[model samples]
Target chain A: MQKKSWNWNRFLACSEENMRNLQLQKLLERNSMSRSIEIERERETDGTKGCCKMEKGSSGYISEFLGSIPTFLRRCLFQVLSFGPIPHHIAFILDGNRRYARIHHLEAGMGHRYGFLALLSILKYCYELGVKYVTIYAFSIDNFKRKPDELQYLMDLILEKLEVVLSEENMVKQYGVKIDFLGNLKLFPEPIRKAAEKVMAATAQNNGTVLLVCVAYTSTDDIVHAIQGLYKEKQARIQQTAEGKQMGDDDEPVECSGGSNLEEFSVSSADLERHMYFAGYPDPDILIRSGGETRLSNFILWQSTFCLLNNPKALWPDISLWHLVWAILQYQRVRPFFEKKKRL
Target chain B: MGANRNGDDVTEINRIHLVGFFPNDLFQITSSWRLDIWNLVIRLCWFLLHQVFNTVHIMMGIKRVLESYFVPSGLLDEYKDLQLKKLRYLAVVVDSEEALQTLRIIKLLQWLSAIGVKHVSLYDMQGVLNKNKETILRSLSNSRLWEESHEKATFLNGGKMTLEFLSISDGREGIAKAASYLCSKYMKAKTLSGNQNERVFTESDVDIALKAVGCGGPEPDLLLIYGPARCHLGFPAWRMRYTELVHMGTLKSMKYGAVVKAIHKFLTVRQNYGK
Candidate 1:
């Protein structure tokens, strides 16, 4: 009986291996077919004059044919993924644009352009995956220490991309993506800051997705900002009470005197939270840092108490949709422990 | 632009263009076909190589797991070398489920002591280690290894090793205490100052509040997390602000090599402190 059971287990393993190999072969065949179709499309585009219309027709047909497989696969995978809990807010520490450019031997500013494109793709994927809030560490306050020329190029590139995104009607109107600049806007120069303001104002009414671009931001700076705001609030309250007292002195004394409540002055965690820049949004569920760095680098320090830190060894420009999918899958695995810890 | 010898050449080129579909272009078709086949062959070879490498890695992992049952002599020396930097304060955070094993805790403590760790803090999200603290200390004291004279068994060179136990409750309670202290301080200051319009509160007020409540502790130079996942598991945030967090994968599969690697990594790291 033991021998028979051992043989049965071996047979089951062998069959599983065979099934995997068969599926792999099928995937390879499909991939090759798609590659051939791409080559044919490229050949048509490179051909002489009369082939343009034919090229468009063939390309459209090939795209429709090729797109069906991924859409189908995505649908199936989405079904499985939807059954698990999804992260509501995801933060990204976009690192290694310069390193990516150096590795690819590209021009100084081109890597950031590619990184911006990758960000757009990831944002679309996250919104589609029902992630409501997406925060990106676009520009840190520390980044200003880079070379003057590179810094200028980055500022220009950011401005140009912001204008392009604002002009793209479908991105805002169709997707309902509200663009928010989540840092000290005063740090930026006039025209670029104005453009950022314009973009935010343009998408103010959209409620579908929130895209927080942390520019000139650091978590420590954010904490200091919150402290300053709280201090100002306390000062304002004191002034209001003093004014009210003066008014009471001039008129009939009121029963409820504001002076007696001076002993009740206190600061609460809620007060500090209310003064935070990210006050309304939920804390990030997952904080992904690309470029293989495991450090937080002063990004969202206070709010990431339970945030799952995912450090994938890929540059910002090299990030793809699967990285986001894998991060969500990891979040699902750890969600139980996180909930348990929170309950305790 | 080549000079054609006859009208046939011109007509031939025109026919070539007019035919549009080059069905007899064997060179073009075969070259692309060869390229496609080459790509497929390379991909297949890569896939096979990856599979072989993965199997070898799994075998190595299993071997490491089996070896973890005993403390090897080589690992002991390596861990001793790792302590050459003299890490003053080290914190080990284990998952709550893994912290239930009291024997494992004693073993880990003994290992740390043998490796010359001067001070160690054991932490878990649940207060299991905290609850079993007295038992753990008693067991260690009764053990022959720890019962040796203090002069002979001193850690790293001369100093005796000390152990501290912490839990999530300590951090949460500390924060709550600090918050209430800040509230009372703020109220007292407001009542003392008759001029309410003056901005009296400063950053030092919060600092003093936390300090008065004894909420702040000396930051750990290095924090090693032993768990199934890499999350911090709500380790005291205030203490770990600048701490180097290294995830030493699951406590059950803990390896000396990983601990050595984490210590080496910490030693080489040059933290700029947000410069």
Candidate 2:
């Protein structure tokens, strides 16, 4: 909301005087290629069916000033920001799309397209800012309760986006971003599931930032899955002898009364974490839910115990660079307390 | 014009007056000072935003109190308001999971009881509320304590309030125990069935097992957190699927109108229950 909309002119104007080419090493060229999502907001006025905009989208969230800013100044700003702590992982709960559409008087379902566009734009900013992981609550398991027609449209849109990500021209391939389709992928239709799998496999070898797209996912389901995964992992390692003893990794597989003697296995805090959907990644330092709502809606509950939760008054489609920066500054402020908690 | 004037002032302030002291290291010194200035500016913005949020929160509290005042006397204590009629279950999440706030807990329960909240769940990560559940329950009048270990129903002033106590144990740790129990059951089932093929349990499978073991419960309609932190404080994930979480500051500074306002807002929100 406008709560965080303090004038950035001081920071911006001050940059001009101090804007000597400090880091002239290599300026990142703005890729002129077609963006993965191009929201044709004007097309919404013509009563067109709500769908993905294949062409470049010039939405309100994607500031032209941000993209067209001199590369050195952008770099200088980030250079200064990098001095303070930058969150290693950031998560987003994209809410308020339908509300945004209603406020703007858009056609039904166009709000989600704008939400997706904002997500891509935000993802680019996060990755560029050196965040190693960015997870989005794309579709929830409860979303299956929506009308059948809306569900079909959503599935189709997701399938198309997955196909785009698999292509060589998309941002995923360009950035070498590893994409993870978390949640119960088994719930999606056959075609959508297949597309999701294909995209995941295609980006499996990427080494850049990781984008976790949670489809049909709930935090409860994730925790249950983590427990199941942990059980399997431990089952392979621990022996099922009369006495419950931890087995070495290289030990021979021993068979016993598997069922009767398995009750002693309990996960320490560490074991469950390694088996979580976000294993090998740090917990998010900040989780922003844009939609003027202050609810998690059953999102990353386990991973966000200490994460700074920012419920900006901005809708999902209206989230811009300033919101992200403000969230980062807030994270920097409270990071010490969370660090102490983690240590304890 | 005002913004431009301020920008000019900032630019002037950005320059260094004592640069001759370190002529060779002036660039390094200048850049460092500029970075510091930028950091201060951003932090100042954040500080102002927090203040704005506080003001909005205080105003919301005032508005709620004023609304209750307009209602007929004893109507709110009776909770005859049509808005809160649909609120079946309410959860109070406190951030202070370590040190027990006995009086605060009692006062909150009494506040909830006055509002005619039938079903209330108290959650803190450290079992502080759960440990003091009996002490808190004893203070209420005509409170018919429920038969369940964690549940209590109090009938006061013709309005009944049911209370459920929860902590971290009832959340992930409870699930962890159930998971181990399920894994053991699955392993034994496979052994008895003589099936070498691995069996992967789904989310529903865990849900069923949890129910069989009496682990999970129905999701609450609203969760009001009493803390500086906006998180659920590890209140069981299984039960908060559709719950609307509202932060009402710390329990020490808790207000009756804030709770009323939170409920009023929750009732007005367009809840599209997908399932």
Candidate 3:
């Protein structure tokens, strides 16, 4: 009986070894399968098709087929969003570029490069969604408070990017975008001011979209500027009136003249409106501030009265297409209220 | 039969030789397999944890929404003890969409009264509140919360609340009127002084002009916005130059907690008006 039991145990051990060997072979097969899938994904991202065949086996073929589905689905979603109610004007307060750099351990000024890329992507998306006007708070008047070196870097970056936008045929020529620098141009260096003028002049007749870059701008300053203009205009009118009175010294008062023409010399709201920096453009429909800050930071104060403010937590450079879509969705929900107010 | 056994032995030897040639490959394959299994287990655990977390979050969100629907008990008492600066003048700017709900406006006023806010300015973009001013005043007066002093009866009773209804027409138009008044005043002063080169107009001149025309209101210490957006919705710009704006979300979902939070936030903030 003991001998029979020993023989049975030996048989059990042999079967266990065979099972282990089978498991090893299965694992090897799965490893190769995953490796091929990784290679296929890389090939698809690279946009090089024939190079995918350089990988030995047909294992990646299935993954290559599956990877295309996501791209296809994304394209479909984009098309659907394009058909939705698009905001006519979108304002962006691009915040947190430096913070993003600090978090990522990137070199100083490298974040602005990434920020520029993000801006380009956003512009493309906005244009695709048929946004007519985009006002970006590129550089605030308070930004000059930064360290001199940092400010210099920012100025250089702005100049470099502005040059690119001017010379890049695909961007300006293809889109026919009108670029307007809305701020105190006198504060800028002569070269930058001249360059901005050249760009504005170049795109003066472009009828596609309007892009307003608020450089060295603050709402307080804009208001003060408008007030000064109104003050000057009022002074000019007073002088003209005095001169007219002097010239008509002996003429009798025209009794039949319209009373409306002799109305009091109070400045009208139209005078202030006409002198505003954004005189021609309609008020921004939506003001988006990234980095989760709630304050307006003195941006477009007069025009933001009826604007929908959307503050997404993502840093400016980290903002995604979904953030924009979500904002538009919120706008769509509140659009009826806006229309109702208009009608009333 | 012996020849057949030898052939089988040779095949076994070849298989062993292949394994020996790539020892690291076998080890790597087994390790990777272990890693894959470990990854699957981790992923499953994470998914389950995420689902549970998401459900809890949704439940909390629902609870908060429900809580906001009703004003919490003792909120007024708690607000009394709050360490805040004297908020003498309070301005509430409601979105036009919310202005249609008279009940909500009344409730907001009642809530403000409970919080011991004596002076309040109610603003709406389309002048809806201004249009319904009589009804709102009547409701407040009739309610037990407000007491009217018969001696000096005005739209706002002297007891606990003094309410002002404002609209967009009162904002920019008022400023323009004030500016016109100031211009005329400056011209008269200039003509009287007969000093064309001298600076006749000062900041105080503009202030006096605005006051003389009764075009400007006392600037609110804190401006609370109850709306779908964070914007002031064209609140009188002249009156809100230094006002601390606190967006309290939509009026439909107004919460006592949020109101207290806004006041607390206002108290903690330090404003530097171009110092």
Cα error, candidate 1, residue A140 (Å)? 2.7
RMSD (Å) per prediction: 17.9, 11.1, 20.9
lDDT, model 3, position A2: 26
Q: Please tell me which model should have the higher DockQ, number 1 or number 2.
A: 2
lDDT-superior candidate, 1 or 2: 2
Clashes of each: 0, 6, 0
- The sequence of per-residue lDDT tens digits that candidate 3 reaches over residues B1-275 is 01111334433433332232335466346554554464344335434433554576469657766544442555445344656336767899998778899998998888777766767889998899989888888888633321233432342335557777788876777667766776665556565566676344443555566667765556777888888556687877666655766777678877776676566556665543321
Give the C-alpha miss distance for residue A12 in model 3, angstroms. Answer: 67
Candidate 2 global TM-score? 0.71
Better of 1 and 3 by DockQ: 3
Assign candidate 2 its CAPRI class.
acceptable
The residue pairs in collision within model 3 are: none
lDDT per residue for candidate 1 within A176-276, as digits (tens), equals 77888888788999998999998988888887779999998876566556656775676566657657877868665532243344445455556666777
Report the Cα lDDT for residue A3, model 2: 12
Every candidate's chain B TM-score: 0.63, 0.68, 0.65
**Candidate 1 residue lDDT tens string, B1-275:** 01111344333332332222223454345464554464344335434433554576479667655544333445444333554464666788899899988887787777666665666777897878888887888877533222233643344354556666777755645544554555445544655564465444343554565568755544577788887667766566556655667777677777765566566667766655433
